[model samples]
Target: MFTLSEPLASVIARLKAPAQQGQIGRLRRGIEKEGLRVDPAGRIAQTPHPHALGSKLTHPHVTTDYSEALLEYITPVYCKPHDALAFLGDLHRFSYHYLGEELIWPASMPARLNGNASVPIADYGSSNIGTMKHVYRKGLDVRYGRIMQAIAGVHYNVSLPDDLWPLLREIDPQASDTAASSDADYRSSRYFGLIRHFRRNSWLLMYLFGASPAIDRSFLDGKPAPDWLEAHGSDTLLSPYATTLRMSGLGYQNKVQEQLKICFNSLSNYVGTLRHAISTPWPPYQALGVNQGDTWQQLNANILQIENEYYSDIRPKRVTRHNETPSQALEARGVEYIEVRCLDLNPLLPLGVDAAQMYFLDTFLMWCLLSDSPWIPDDECDHLDDNRRLVVERGRDPAMRLNIGGELRSVPERGHEIFTELEAVAELLDILEEGSPHSDAVRGLAPLLDDPSLTPSGRVMARLKETQQSFAEVMLALAREQAEQFRREPMDAAHRALLDELIETSHRQQGEIEAGDEERFGAFLEGYFTRAREPRAARAV
Candidate 1:
């Protein structure tokens, strides 16, 4: 069995006190899940985002992601995982009423495609902010193509209790004077520490929850598959031991972003790196031109149009105010929460995620926070990425070995070591809670470490082999099944009423914003980027 580090053990011991343990109960979490809209025939839907779903630009809950067909569901923060999930379910049920004949695509990989043109970019309306949103997406289409924009996934947002910060500061002796400068600084630093540890250990999450092991051949768009991806059925390409091909090079992974070294060691470094990327021009993008006559071809010729373009498995976030950028919010205040961006949508699960998985996530995130995390050096960051790619491509392989702190360790061995620590964290979280649910969740998923077949990816591959169905065919059937189930279920009366009100209100709000816009699009665009480029410290002042 793996033993906990002295720092982790010491913190766990301190957290065992009733007062410190009570703070754990105050954790808040939310979910933002995205799914593509496909027709009954399982092809990408050509229709616009349904009108009854409310304004994609103004709706607080439902919105379009990269494409009009990619529906994103946002849940309000809830203290309990089940409450958040309940809200997400209500959102799904509410959406189905307006969906007509379209079904929410159940998988992370896109449904059948007819090249890049089939995926329509989302149009947020003519308001300056909405126009900027649309143009940024248009830039994405020019740079990466619309096909990649259709891929969907879940983003798990979470924040530790406010009361937990002081305790964390007290427990970590090496938190340093920099973190000791202010409460915001200390909390931000600690969150970055959590992010560092998370980045290092995130491969474990891929092994446990990754569900996209196969994709329909249509996703390839006539391109040949790599030698490593073997043919599954006639219409599918798969990696036998791969966990999340969605996270692999084939999906959201970008070649240009590979060169970016965003620092998670501190909030300032993080902001600096992002700002530099957005400010620096890239030749390839510059060649595309920012505009053609009156039409905006792209947002800018920079390496990134905005901070959001530089994607990562995780992000340090603070809620932005009106007309503020994400970085501005973080700098003006501090990291309010961290967003887990790497989770795949399990087609088998109606919500793409489940309660037990939520409990496990809570346990895992808490473990990351309480662990002894050191700053990752340049070489270590590259190593972390390599480990993640290895797991993404061939995680379920029994013979697979991963680099753990510079040593080669078998997947099971390293996983077990991590779980040992996770169990201790789960225990602290489960205090005052009924039935040790968090600890139970950790123990429940522990078996997947030893038994690959129990994993979502493993199960998916197994089903495909047993049924001899194409990836698209299997997912289409599952989508239909899930849609029927949602239709049969009764939505909460209170939630149903609230959604009805919001749909109407959101439409009005979108119109008001558009009508109120006085500045030209060109001027608005310039001002937005100018504010984004201003010194974050100045903005904070």
Candidate 2:
């Protein structure tokens, strides 16, 4: 059992702790002496550039060496040599979009999203490939803005040991972890392993969520859109997170189609609560207002319902357009982690991450996990559907509340708990990292919380407010600043030369594939898929 040992009490103590003077002063002085533009709340301002809205949007899983990375993480590498699926560039989408839901019917949707990439492509017509954005970027300020936080992602799933499968569902929860646990429930050998396995192979485990909404061209706003992509692109997205033949049966090749069908039914039971935007009066057809019949105000009455029954982390609604913006669940059959689908990368960072901030996220996720993450009870899941509407349009208002624990709690309290727990996690990371740079970095989150005016989101809001610029303007400014910094740190010379060599090798491989070198390519894909499909075999190798 891999216990999460960072004790809660010890870490919580740091919530009120102030930043160390040495680092704080140096940070302040660095900004002051350099005349760096700090926002009203004392954070560096974003600079302007061509892709100024998006600094280099290099996400982690997307940045690894393709074959080596697959070997290291997923195992097995099948598909075409230029197989975009086998590449790490695409797989990062899954890691990027760690939220607990999927983006449905993007085929006719045209959206302008500044994701975890360098430039905010002005118009991303209908392709959903590599479209998932993590709740926040990997190591940075990725938490959703105030209103969005309440819509938490959770999984109300039951698990079974390899042997207990058919009989697992009727099992008791007092025997499981969620509510009123039974003695055998927590100790059940299948519990955490199911979760760990889900977490590890999450991208591949797309259970058919529900009927995807119709694609709406009107969502495009006059932009030229591309052809529609596969509904659940993250499942097949390029990046180190992808699935190859080797990765099969770790989750794939299950002959138990009925077991999978049961999983779909379970998921459908939850999704049933959400009616389409057209059918629901709550969404109010582009008007952010109140009405009856399961309105947001009603939904907010129980924040937990929003968090558990309705919210997601990955593939959030696109900011620029509304077509295909409706919630979607692919029709499939399987059991897996819920997908969260909303996150926009802050354009001003590198790798879209930082160390100290990661502690904030770690604690936040733990809170989501430790607190009551429930399944959509048979009665409540549907009445609380229109969460994204409230978030995108009315998220910043602190007065707003949403359902949680079957009742509404102020969003601030939710934020506090998460942030507070994060500070504590920082303390633990400091201890773990010891004297490493990561230790000092972990403590830096306090400063971020103390001065929310300084975070990337905060800064963007401030800049937009101060300059009275469109979101696009704020984006350009940040992009330029990040680009300037990235440009200065050009690829190392040795790395560039090595890249040149790899390119030549790659060109030769291409020729082999072009010559229909079936034996060679087939051998490679087979070996790779087999190795990937069998994790134990790869590890043994």
Candidate 3:
């Protein structure tokens, strides 16, 4: 029988009490979607960023990721999921107006990359920080091929209110004891606990929502394709039972990263290990060197050029202040929120993700936070890695078995167990919201497990088969369709005005930053690395 942990059961009961039902509006969320700018021929566009969009470095809403062509849209934090998605739609509408004949590719896996030189690294202007950003991308091109960096996805950021934690601590006496620490420290510790549990159950999310089961052949970049992947045409590859090839070894895989053992058992250990990596030089990267003549190729020969290079399915995050590193910000302010990084762009949706997915995420994360999360030993961490690889590669295979607590369980059976627990959490959410959105979203997953063909990956594959089209062809069609839909729907006048103002403001901001620099680029780089190596100290309240 599936059973909830004692603390979870008690919290649920208290949350369902008559007095607390309508007070659950404290969950805040934000969304970030990355899309590649592509030409009408379905190739990644080599054109410079559109002038109307302003500077990629200073733009508040729209910015570039690794490639200048990869545009990332960020929404302001919002209490209601619908409002956040609506803001995303507005950003898209504004983008389409300036795209001319170009279009934003609608899939998580990117359009074709002809070669290394074809992908342009983003330029942020003449400031030292701006140059550092460009050099980091150059280092990525050296370490991992630019082709791998081109893959795009959606990130969902979420945080619970301060009021909810005290209630949780009251129900769990063990948590109450930790109240001796400052609220910031307590919250950071609890958020790390949440992260550990999220890692254990994250595979279930891949099974439910993973959509990138196929990709264009050119993404392979002339390398031999894996045996399990079948060619659909001269230009496309398909996987029969794959869920998210985007998360597979073929996607963001880096052989060198395997050596770094990053632990999430506590905030101190997590920060300590990452600090070591940033300082420790790697032999392979050292051979590449930091610069060739006057041109800077990378920041340093360290294992990671910066903290952002360490990619994972989810991350504990704190918003950084000006000139602060990610680690510095975390040590100072604690975990303000978490960024869920594994979601693929559901090409069928105009905003990449919809409200139903958002509701499901909230329930799933709550389950992760409230569940009994034991400390993961080294061997179990290896097992967790294996399980994630299995699901991302072949999750839809009915006979596939996963390692759950040393017991082998069929994927569907395990999925059923997870959903059963999730449904209970969904009911609690429904009681909190005075409606059934969360409950209805949980119930909707039932058909997906019973009939694999109903899953997002299944639906994508089915469409490919029925249309007799390559991945690129199908994705391009969807992109055009979505573009037309956004073009026809009237954009909010206020949002249009906001976009214009932001573009002008970003341009001025970039100019100001470039002109205000006093330190030489070399001295600035030295100072930044020096600060990164400093011991962790809590910021004064």
Candidate 4:
């Protein structure tokens, strides 16, 4: 019953050609997953990063995030989603061999925290680059507190095949009219369009995949719980109908960032806004000071320490070269891919996500790209944020309604309309496959729109109710269970050997980097900011 936009319908018709199938099958994706390391009692581990796991500063695959206890695993890009997941699974298995009794916390929320001080900031080493990383984290410690930095989630990185660009450009109305539509310009514009559409509709992802509905009382430190939250047990706080508290105000929200209206209509606009934020000083951060005596406090007194500090649900990305900032990379080579940063860890799965979910994500992302997306103005941006907040806090409410185009509509009704379009995209993708896996993934998850209990967050809440266990207790049990299963499964001998070699090489690389540094830290810091402050011209397509 859903009506496809004229642009979308035209693209689908063209994509059905025999010559386009190969390009469609060439999509690539990668995953970056973060998990907190905790002891058997579910307390955040106070130990330094395990030595056998390799140097966090130089390791390509294994590293630390905001805290030493927060382990981040990265996988290289793969054509098939399952292959990427297999690599992720191997990382977990290899780490378990050296983790001893420690377990990786399974949920998006942090494990039982002692306080802000208990969350140790990550230490990278003595190199200038290492020092910069550590100092940047300290800035986050002062800006948002270490407790919020301890929250973990999954980041999915994906890129359409290069060969598909010419096909899209041929179909683009604007490109057809323009005389100078370079490959770089067209790709970036299409990515921004995809991002705009994603910003407007990513709430659907939270409703389906969000898993952090409850948290341990200790997560708030000594602060009182908000009225919206109800006590689930002596030590657990929850919102009965919430989907992802990890994405709500209770989690990573910052008042200062809320004021930053970062534009996504064009690549230059995005770069310019980010540069202004990093270069402009804020009063509160200025009070903290960049240096105290000989000890470094932060990178600067700006609104953001770096581009990475500016958080968004989705981001246009380009892999940066050595010493080049992210914006510089985009200005030089345009967007290479996009990263989806709003997904919560599904504690029900050992890897937090599965093949079926990845298939659905691929379908949904394609639908966003194919849909007709207009540039979003500031007022409309605010409305999108409001919609996301509503779904995050009260998504499972039976009578919840969303303000779609100023008209109020029930969640199920809107969800079904979107899914109908998704089903069409799925069929297009499944053209060359033996089974309709992509279409099957879309159809299988469609029922969750009407049945809230079938959602991950709902399943977690049901577990808490049936077991009468606190949030920490339930998560710890899952962690232990998953850890045992990982240990029992045999890792590929070749993969294990590769990991072993990487551990030694990572340590050596860090040592060489520290020894090779001759530039003063202050000079390097100044040069870094100078490069970031360079003016960017509007690169609109």
Cα RMSD for predicted model 1 = 1.4
Give stretches of model 4 more than 4 Å off: 18-21, 535-541
Model 1 lDDT per residue over 1-541, tens place: 4698888988888988954446644679999999999999999999999999999999999999999999999999998988998999999999999998999999999999999899989999999999999999999999988888889999999999898887777777875756527788778888998999999999999999999999988888898998889898688999999999989999897788777787498888998888888899999988999996659979899989998888889999999888788988888888999999999999999999999998999889888988878889999988899999999999999888898888999789999989999988888888857788889999999999999999999999999999999999999999999999999999999999999999889999999999999999998888988988986563331
Question: Each candidate: how many clashes?
Answer: 0, 69, 0, 0
Question: What would you estimate as the lDDT of candidate 3?
Answer: 0.86
RMSD of 2: 19.0
* Reference-based TM-score, model 1: 0.98
Each prediction's Cα lDDT score?
0.90, 0.26, 0.86, 0.90
Candidate 1, which ten residues in sequence have the lowest lDDT sum? 18-27
Q: What is the TM-score of each candidate against the true structure?
A: 0.98, 0.39, 0.97, 0.98
Error of 4 at 212 (Å): 0.6
Local error of candidate 3 at residue 287 (angstroms): 0.4
State each model's C-alpha RMSD to the native. 1.4, 19.0, 1.5, 1.7
Global fold similarity of model 2 (TM-score): 0.39
| Model 2 segments more than 4 A misplaced | 1-220, 223-341, 366-374, 378-389, 424-429, 435-455, 490-498, 517-541
lDDT of 3 by residue, 1-541 (tens): 7676566777678867632555555589999999999999889999988889988888989999999899999999998888898889999999998999899998999997798777888888899888989988999998887888888999999997767776666666576577578778877888888899999888988887888999998888788999999988788898899989999987877777777766488888888878888999999999988976558888999988898889789888998887788888888888989999989888878778899999999989988877777788889899888889888988888878889999998777777777877887888777656578888888887778878888888899999999999999999999999989888887789888988999989999999999999998888889999988876578754
Q: Give the TM-score of candidate 4.
A: 0.98
Ranking by lDDT: 4, 1, 3, 2
Model 2, span 452-489: residue lDDT tens = 34444445445545775443334445544543444444
